[model samples]
Structure formats: C-alpha cells, structure tokens
Target: IKTAVEKIDIDVPNWTFVAARLFLFDLYHRVGKSTHGIKGEPYCHLKEYLKYGKEAGRLIPNLGEGYDLDDLNDYIDSDRDLLFNYLGIKTLYDRYLIKNKEGNPIELPQHMFMAIAMFLAQNEENKQQRAKEFYDVVSKFEVMLATPTLSNARTNRHQLSSCYIGSSPDNIEGIFDGYKEMALLSKYGGGIGWDWNQIRALGGMIDDHKSAAGGTVPFLKITNDIAIAVDQLGTRKVAIA
Candidate 1:
C-alpha cells in the first residue's frame, strides 16, 4: 500500500483530487499504522489475517531477523487473540486486513488497531495509553465516528468533517464572505450546511432600506452553484440537507 501510494500518479487532476480525499480522510482514518512506526490509530487494526495464516500452519515469514527478541516476542505473542470478538475477527479478515505485495497478510489485528488508536490519540501526551484507550473505545459500541472521521483524524490530512457555516448579509460583500467560507470548507473536505434562510427574501427591505433584498431561492441557487464549482476533493460533499 505504501508502494502504491508512492508510485501513484497524481498528474490527472481528478485522480489527484480523489487521492487527496482518501489520503487525508478515508485512508488515514482506516489505516492503523505504517510499517515505519508513525503512530496512527485509524489504520491500526487492519491485521487479522496473519493469525488465520498461523491456524493454517503458515508461520509469518521472517518473523524475527533484525528485531530485538523481546520486541519480537511481544509482537508475535498470542495475546492479540483476546482483543477481538468473533464478528470483529471475521470483519477484519473480510474487509480491513491489509496484505503485502505478494498477497501475504502483513498486519495483525492488535497491531492494526493499536496503530490506528495511536494515530487518533496522537494529541495525547502518553501515546501508548491514548492508543489503548482508542482501541478500547473502538472494540466496544460505546462510541463510534463516521468512516471519514475514523479514517483521517490524526494524520497530515486534517480532513475533519463536522459543520460549515456561511454568513451572508444583503450585500455583495456578504455574498462573497459566504462564498469564501464555502471555498474554505471545500478545501478542508467538509460538508457545508448553510442557513440560507437568514438571507432576506427577494424585494425585501435590507441594509437600512437602501436596497431591496434578493429572495432566498436566487441566493440559494447562487450558493448551490458555488458549491458545484468548488469540489471538495471527494472526501466530503456539500448538500442542502
């Protein structure tokens, strides 16, 4: 996956846009960790297939070569077996498990989850505890975030989709301000929920009665057009609802 990302061609604007979307939002949230050891909780738990391999009489190739014995033992120990439930185990294999270039599973469930947990908890002072807390939260149903939030929280891509507000008055400058907010939201891959209702209805008194107001629908169409023009890298979308 790392190789795929490195070699991915970003020349096509649309492709690049989509890649940017996933890179900042989807992939980051989904990936527990990279082999390079950057802590990311979102992508951490994508490694359950390796255990399946052991059950099939296949040892993870090159289990211990350059690593410390204690580290290897800690990583390879069967304690990870206790982390997941039956359904989570099955889902990990079916959807989330990442594989090597040769299609061999390179991730284990605990490693993957811990990697993602760490990524999400990167802001915490004690990363290990934060990662473990994240893992505990995700392991159960106490709290859950959307797929995009889950994918991109603590990475280089600060693609957090929550709320977008556009403040427009009755004048052109107000319209521009709203448009600017929309553009900013698009850049950050956030869904915009504009309160166009605040915009005065057409032919209504506004701005100390110097000018008439444009109705909500016309400005609504204009706002909609603005959204259409500025695409949000595909990770988030702007809609009326």
Candidate 2:
C-alpha cells in the first residue's frame, strides 16, 4: 500500500486506483480471516455478514430481515466496487463501513452501499425494486448521500439526517438544554446550527440579584468542548455553526 501510494503523482494519478486495489486486497484478506476464512471474495455470504454485524451490535438487529437474502445477495454487483478511487474507498472503509467492537471492518464498500439502500427502501411499496434502484445509483456513484446518512443508515444508531438547527434561548435552563441537545445530536453524526445570538453580551446583568453574565464566549467554549468530546462515534469531529 505504501509503495503504491508513493507512486501516485500528477504524472501517474491512476496509481491511486492501484493503491485502492491493494488496500482493498488487504481489507478483504483481513475481513475474510476474521469472519469466513475466504480470502479475495468479500461478498460471498451476504446473509451471514448481516447476521454477524447484528450480533456484533454494529448493525440494527432487524437489518436484512425484511428482504429476501438470496435476492439481495444476488442483486449486489461486486463489479461496482471498481467505481471507487483510492480516497473514496478509503473514506468509506474508515468512516462508513460497519466495524465490530474490535474495530475491524465487517463490510466492504459495496456492502455499505447495499445496506444503505436496503434500509432506506425497506418501507416502500415495492421495496425490492426500490432497493435495487437505490443501490444502482449509489454504488455506481451516480448519486451522493449526506455524511450522516452514509454513516448511520444501516447502523444501530440510525440518525440519518445531515444537520439540525435550533435556538438557544436566553435563560439558564435553555442554555444548558441546548448544550445537551448538541451533544446528543453530535453523538449520532449530526452537525448542529445553533442560534446563540440571544445570549447576553459580556458583563450583562443576569437578573434581579445584580449578577453579571459572563457573556456568550463562555457558553461558546462549552459548545466547543462538546464538539471535541462527542466526535460522531469516532467517524469524524462534530461540525458546529
């Protein structure tokens, strides 16, 4: 992987694909040894993979239960794995694929895309067809999903929205509640847009007791800490605005 990555330059940018293939080879070998002992073929047992993810608590318990495993497995086109370049596949491997408690990836890029499609289309009238359509566009790189949707769609966390917007009112309870809400949302891969303009400026009066407020900077510092502490389950740091 190091050799292939070093070979990539402006003159030979396609080496990224070579590096991706090498990394994928290593990933497949690791997953196979850890799971089914079948190297070079990561998509061989779709049903078993889903079951293992559920048992490991990386995936929702009901994942793959409503679909025909045989059909879904057949629908998975391993050829689509070729669509991803190095950075794309690496990002998916690092952040999106479901990992066990031991922090090893249990699903491949195609598996992640298929799982997202299945979870999203599970409630449709013709769910099997809808799932196929979703898989087709996503795996082929014809559409892009938001970060949270890509990361949490098939996982037990399942908070698939991109971001949330809310206001922090100008009261003690409301300020703390806003902080708590941001923490919870960040825990599940959601970005936050908080309206803190209502907070008093520096040295403002607090109430009838003639207490002085420390202003929004102190509250903003708390939010900054929350962003660092709750880092979206290690996928990425929280984004706050």
Candidate 3:
C-alpha cells in the first residue's frame, strides 16, 4: 500500500486504479493457495475452490449442495474489476472482502458479487440465471446490498443485514439483559441502537425502597466495554450503540 501510494504521489495517476488491481492480485493468490496450494496461480478448475470450501465447511454450510458450483466460473465476469473507483475498491478490500484463515482475500471483485448473488438465489428454480441477474445488478453499480450482505454473504458464519435496533424497558434486570443482548449482537458484527429513554435521570430514586438509582449513564457505561470486548472482525474498535 505504501508503494502504491508513493506511485500515486509521483505522477502515476493510474496507480490509484493499479492499487485495486494490486488487491485483485492478492485475492487471486489467495484463491490459488486455497484451491491448489500454489500462490499466484489461478485454479485451472475454479469450481474446485467452492467444492473445497464446502467440503471443509469453510463456506456457506451447504453451499451449492443441490445447486451447482460449476456454473460460477461461467458466471463470473472479471472485466468488472475495472468498474470500481479507488475508494470503492479500497473499502471492499479493507473491510468487506472475505478472507481465508491466513487473512488473505479469496474472492475477487466479480467473485464476491457472484458469491452474494448465488447465496441469494440458492432456492430459486433457475439459480444460475437468477444469480447472474443479481450479479449484474450489483456489479454494474445499479444497486448494492446492505453492509452485512457485503460482509457476510456466502461466508461460513454469515450474519447478513446491517444492524439491529431494538430495546427493552429500563430496570435492573432489563438493563443487564439489554447489555447481554447487545453484547451478543456485537459479537456477530452488529451495530445495535437500544432505547434507554425509559431509564430515570441521574441520581433518580428507586420506587421500591427509595434508594438512589445510578440512572441511565451508569447503565450505559458498560456498553462501551462490552463493545470493546467483542470487536467487529477486530476492525471496528467498539460497538456502535
């Protein structure tokens, strides 16, 4: 990236585009390694990658079980890599691209789009055509899925959809229960918006014993900690609450 940036500064304007290509290079290497144990070489039979992922249970649990992965290679259009701008491609490579155990991206730009499309069209009667249509919609920048769909679709532990916003009434048990729920959602890379309006103000008195309640601030304090505890893919430093 440093080298890519330096090239960008030194009058190689196309280096901005080249940076995404560099990321594509990394992705191809990862696929090569995963499918054939050979870095920097593409799999001669690309479907083997999906086959291996399913066999190893590293992809969507029952990926292409009834459908066919062979159609994937036929569907993927690598020319779409040119469609991305610098920031668009950078965001994908950094935050959304699926990675292998070694932290290498296994999906190319087209492959990622197709993976998401296939996952969405798995139950369709004509899956390949439906997947292709979906891929065309997204790859052409005509429409895009939610962040979670970009991040988790076709993944082994898919938690697709962007965020969760639900709440519970305020109380000792409710506050703690909300915390537990928030923590679980955050654990799976969700941004939760919990309603805390029902809680009393600072130093508010409890109705039962007339004791001073710590109020909403005290209850919300642990939220930051819980978010930190279960970071999103270890990228987002804390949960968005």
Q: Give the TM-score of candidate 1.
A: 0.48
List ranges where model 2 is wrong by over 4 Å: 209-211
Candidate 3, residue 210: how far the Cα is off, in Å: 2.3
TM-score of candidate 3 to 2 decimals:
0.83
* Residue-wise C-alpha lDDT for candidate 2, range 1-241, written one tens digit per residue: 8998889999999999999888888888877766775655667667888888888888888877678878888888887777778898889888888778788877888778888999999899989889999999998888989989998899877798988998998999999988889999999989889898998888778765354888889888998998999988788889999
The predictions' CA RMSDs to the true structure, in order, are 14.4, 1.5, 2.9
Between candidates 1 and 2, which one is better according to TM-score? 2
* Candidate maximizing lDDT: 2
User: Where does candidate 1 stray beyond 4 Å?
Assistant: 1-116, 139-142, 205-212
Candidate 1 structure lDDT? 0.49
TM-score of each: 0.48, 0.94, 0.83
Answer with 1 or 3, whichever has the higher lDDT. 3
Q: How accurate is candidate 3 locally (lDDT)?
A: 0.71
lDDT of 3 by residue, 1-241 (tens): 5477567754567777777677666666766665564654444344665666565555776665665566766766777877775667878878776666677656567767877888888889988788889989999989988776787778765777567897768677887888888877776667888888888776677776454777777666677778778877764554466
What is the lDDT, from 0 to 100, of the residue 115 in candidate 3?
72
Candidate 3 wrongly placed segments (more than 4 Å): 9-13, 37-46, 235-239
Q: What clash count does candidate 1 reach?
A: 28
Candidates' C-alpha lDDT: 0.49, 0.85, 0.71
